[model samples]
Target: MVNHNTQLLSESETTISYANRGLNYGDAVFETLRVSAGKVLFWEDHYFRLMASMRIMRMEIPMTYTPEFLEAEILKTVEAEGQKNKTYRIKLLVWREEGGKYTPTAKDVSFCITTEILENPFYTISGDFYEVELFKDHYVTAGLLSTLKSNNRIINVLGSIYAQENDYANCLLLNDKRQVVEALNGNIFLVNGYKIKTPPLSDGCLNGILRKQIIKILGQVPDYILEEASVSPFELQKADEIFITNTIVGIQPISKYRKKEYGNTVAKELLQKLNVKARLG
Candidate 1:
C-alpha cells in the first residue's frame, strides 16, 4: 500500500507522472523513519527535521502538516498494509508540484508515504566484518543546502557503486575542503580512548536523527566525551572505534578501514542504551 497525499492506494494503482517535479528535477525532501508496533521512533525529531528541510528548500508548507496530523498519516499508511503490529521502515517524501522549468510556477507541494518490513524492532550491534573506504571521486559542498535531506545525492549513488565494486561495506564522503563528512548512507562517528567525535553539520554531514539521539546518549555517559567537530581522513586510521548511525540501522560499527581494525566494545554498550531509550519513548 502507498499513501499519496492522504489517499490510500494499492501498489498497482499508485502511479507518478513523468512531469512530477520530484522525479524530473529532484525537487523533494524526505524522512526515513522506524515504526515499531505502530509507534514511530523519535517522531518529534523526524517531524521537525522534515519541516526544517522543507523550509530550507523553499517548499511550501501545507497548513495541515502539524506533527499530530503527519504522524496519523504515517500510521494510516502502515495500517493500510497490515504492518501496524510489526516493525517497519517508513519513508515520507514531500515534493513541489509539477510546473515551470527551473523556476516552479507554484509553491504548493505533494507527499507520499511508503513502507517495508524490518527485521529488528530495536537497536542492535552486528558482528559482521564491515569495512569502509574514502570515496574521493566526488566531494560534498560545505554549506547549509548540503545539510538538507533533499534528493540531490548523485555523490551518494556513485559512492555506493564504488563500494560495491571494491567489496567494501560502506564509503565515507568528504567535503570540497577534503574533510571527512559522513558515510554514504548515514553519519559517521569516530572513537579514540574516551573521546567520541562526529563531523558537525557545517562539515556537510546529514543531520541524522539517530546521530542526535546518540549524541544525547553520549552526553549522559561520563565515561566518554562527545565532540561535534570536523574529522579528517587521517583520524580514521588512529581511531579506536568507528560507528555509523542512521534511522534504519541505529548503529553499525566499522570493523576495518584499510589495514586498521576496530573493536565494538563501545558500540555494544551504546546499542543497549539506545534500545532502552527507544522502548521508554
Candidate 2:
C-alpha cells in the first residue's frame, strides 16, 4: 500500500494555488535512500547526489537538510518509525508543491521512510530464464535533462511498461545512437571473461550510486576491465555475463537476453563481492 500523506490528509489543508510547478508541470527532484540497521546506508552519498540534482535544477533543499538539522531529523524519523535494526526504504522528494503558473513560485518538500523487505540482489528471484531485447542506438538521443532527476519519467515509465508487457524481466533502453545505455531502472554492466564494461556517462545515463560502487570495486582489480564504450546488441551477446546495478535492485544478473542465456560464474562471483562491499562499506 502506497501510504502517501496526501491520500490520508486530503481534506485537511488544500494548498491549492492557481498553478504550482509540481502540479502544473513536473518540475521537481527526488531521491530514494536505503535504510539499514536504523541508519541509511550511503546516506551521505545520497544527500550529495540529491544536492547535486537540486543544483542542476536550480532548486534549493529545505532548511531541514542544513548541516545542523539534517542528521537529527533523520534520526528522529527513523526512531519514530521503530525501524531500528531493520532495513527499510527512504524516499525524499522536494518539489514545487505550491502551484503557480508554469514556473515555480514556491515549493514544498516531503520525506517518507518506510519498511519493506527488499530481496538481496545476490539472490536472484525464482523465475525462468528471462529474455532481453537488444536496444538499438539510443545514445544519440538528446539528453537535455540528463543531469537533473526530474519527475518527468516518460522514457523510464514507457520502457518498464514495455518490459512487463513483453514478458522480459527488464527492458534495455538505448539512446538514439543505438548504444546500450541502461535498463529501464538499473545501470547495465557486462562481464566478459575478466573484463567488465558499462556505458560511459556520456552515453546518457544517471550516475547511480550503486553503479559508482561497482565501478570503484572493479577499479581495484588489475584483471577487471571497465569500458565506457558504445556497446551494441552483438557485443552484449558476446559478453560472458551481464549484470545491472541500482539502488533498489542492487546488482542483478541477466539469465537470458533474447534467446541467449548468459549464465556466467564471473557475474555471480561479482555479485557476491558486491554484497560484502555493500554490507561492510
Candidate 3:
C-alpha cells in the first residue's frame, strides 16, 4: 500500500476546495524527484526550479515556505511512509488556491508532498532497450511556459497513450514547427558519430533536471561534442544512437526506433558515470 501525506502551507488539510484553480484551470506546477537513502537528490536544483515555475505562474508563495522548511516536510512524509532508507518517487505539487471564471480568487499557493515507495532499491539501467516512435497528432507550442513542468500536459498524455496503443515503450513529441522536441516521459538525445544532438529549450522542451546534468557531464568529456540544435524526425532516424534522460530513469538507450537498431555503448558509459556521480555526491 502507498501512504499519502499532504500539507498546505502550515496546515495538514486533506481536502482542497472544489473550485481550486489547479483543478479547474490547471494553474499549478510540480516536480518529480528521486529520493534515495534518505536523501532527495539535487534538492536545491529541484527547489529552485519549483520556485521559478511558481514565479512564471505569478503565484504568491507563502513567506514561511523556505527551502529548508519544505525539505523537512518532504522528509517527514518519507519517514512516515517508512521509506527513509529506501528509494522512492517523490512529487511536490504547488497549485493556486480556489478561484472562478478563468481567474484565481487568491494568488496564494497550496502545495502537497506525496511519496511512493519504489520496488527497486536503486535506479537500475534497463537491460532491455526502449522501443520508441514519433508522435505527431498534436504539437507542443513554443512560448514562455513551454519549459516549465506545469499541470498543462495534454500533449504529453496523448503521446503516452499513443505509445501504449501502438506497442511502443515511448514516443517522441514534436513542436509547433514540427521539430523533434522530446519524448513522452523524458528528453531525447541523438548520437551522430562523435557528436550528440538534443533539441534546445527554444524547441519547446521541458528544461528537465536530468537533461541539464547530462549536458554538464558531456561538457567535461573531450572526445564527444554535445550540440543543442533543432532536430527533425528524419535526422533523428538517421542518427547512430538514441537515448533518453529523466529524474527517475537516469538514462536509457533506445534499441529500436522503427527498423533502425541502435547500440547502447554511449548510454552504458554515461550511466556508469552518472551512477558514480550519484554515489560520490
Candidate 4:
C-alpha cells in the first residue's frame, strides 16, 4: 500500500496490442477528472461526454460502468498517491485500442488509470493569482476535432509554451475571428455589471465540465441565467473580471490580460460561492 503512491496506468501495464489502432492512427478518447474527499465530482457528465465522443467516432464503450466503480478507482489512486499527504489528482485515461490496421476492430478495449502525484496546494481563484494574454501565432477552430477530446493537444501545448516564454500564466485562445472562445484548457467567464457571459459552443470551445457546472449552479440564481454567445475581443476587454474554470484548476481569475488591469473583485466572490456550492452540490 505504501509503495504504490498513485493508481494510474502505465504503458507497461499491457503487452503489445493487436493491430494498434491507438498507436498507429491516434484513435483514442479519454477524460480528465479531479478526485477529492474520496469522491469524483460530476462523474456522470464526464461519462456523458466520453460516450458522446465514442458515438461520434463510431466506437463502443462500456456504458454500464457504475459511478461507484469510478469512485473506487479514484479513491484508490488518491490514497496511493497521497498515502500520508491526504490530497491528490487523478487522470482516468481510456484508449480505443486493438483495432487492426487503420480501422477499429470488432471488439477491443484497453485503459490506463494513472494518478499523478499531488503537490502541496491546488490552484483556485482563492489562491495566488495569474494573468493571461491574447495569443497571436496559433489558433484552434471547431472544424477539426473541436467536438472531440481526442489525443491531439498540440495546439494547447504550443500556446502554453508561448505563454511561458512571454512571462504570462496562461494564454487566452481565440478562433480565426479573434473572439474569446476559451483558455488553453478551460472555458472563460466574463463578469460585467451584475451579469456573467461566456462564449457559446458555436464559438469553438471545449464545453468543459466545470463550465457546465458553473452555468447550472448560476442559472438557478433568478437574475443570472449565465448566457452563452459569441463574446468578442472588444467586449472581453471591457469586462470587470475574467475567470476560467476547468476540472483541476476549479476556478482561476485573471488579474490582468496582456498588462491591462481588470480591477474588479467579483471573481473572488463568485469563486467563494462556487467553492461552497461545489462542496455541497
Report the number of the highest-lDDT candidate: 1
Question: For candidate 3, lDDT tens digit of each residue in 164-231?
Answer: 89899999998999998998888988998889999999989999998988898899888799999999
Model 1 weakest lDDT span, ten residues long: 119-128
* Winner on TM-score (3 vs 4): 3
* Residue 155, candidate 4: C-alpha displacement in angstroms: 0.6
- List lDDT for all candidates, in order: 0.93, 0.65, 0.83, 0.70
Order of all candidates by TM-score, from best down to worst?
Answer: 1, 3, 4, 2
- Candidate 3 differs from the real structure by a C-alpha RMSD in angstroms, to one decimal, of 2.7
Write one digit per residue (lDDT tens) for candidate 1, span 1-281: 79999999998998998999988999999999999999999999999999999998998898999999999999999998875788999999999999998999988999999999999887788768999999999999999988888889999999999999999999999999999999999998899999999999998889999999999999999999999999989999999999999999999999999999999899889999999999888
The true-versus-predicted C-alpha distance at residue 92 of model 1, in Å, is 0.2
Instruction: Write candidate 2's Cα lDDT for 1-281 as tens digits.
Output: 12233232222433444554654577767776676665566667777887787777767567656633554455555555554565656666666556456665655555433335454423343345656775332332436466345677677777667777778788787777677778777788888777788887777777688888888878876877888777776787788788787776666778887656787576556666767776775
Off by over 4 Å in 1: none
- Screening candidate 1 with a backbone cut-off below 3 angstroms (N, C-alpha, C), the clashing residue pairs are none
Candidate 1 displacement at residue 136 in angstroms: 0.6
For candidate 1, what is the lDDT? 0.93
Weakest ten-residue segment in model 4 by summed lDDT: 1-10
What's each prediction's TM-score? 0.98, 0.82, 0.93, 0.84
Residues 20-105 of candidate 4 have per-residue lDDT tens digits of: 66666767777887655655657788878877777776776664445666556666656655463544555665566564566556
**Residue 28 in candidate 3, Cα distance off native in Å:** 0.6
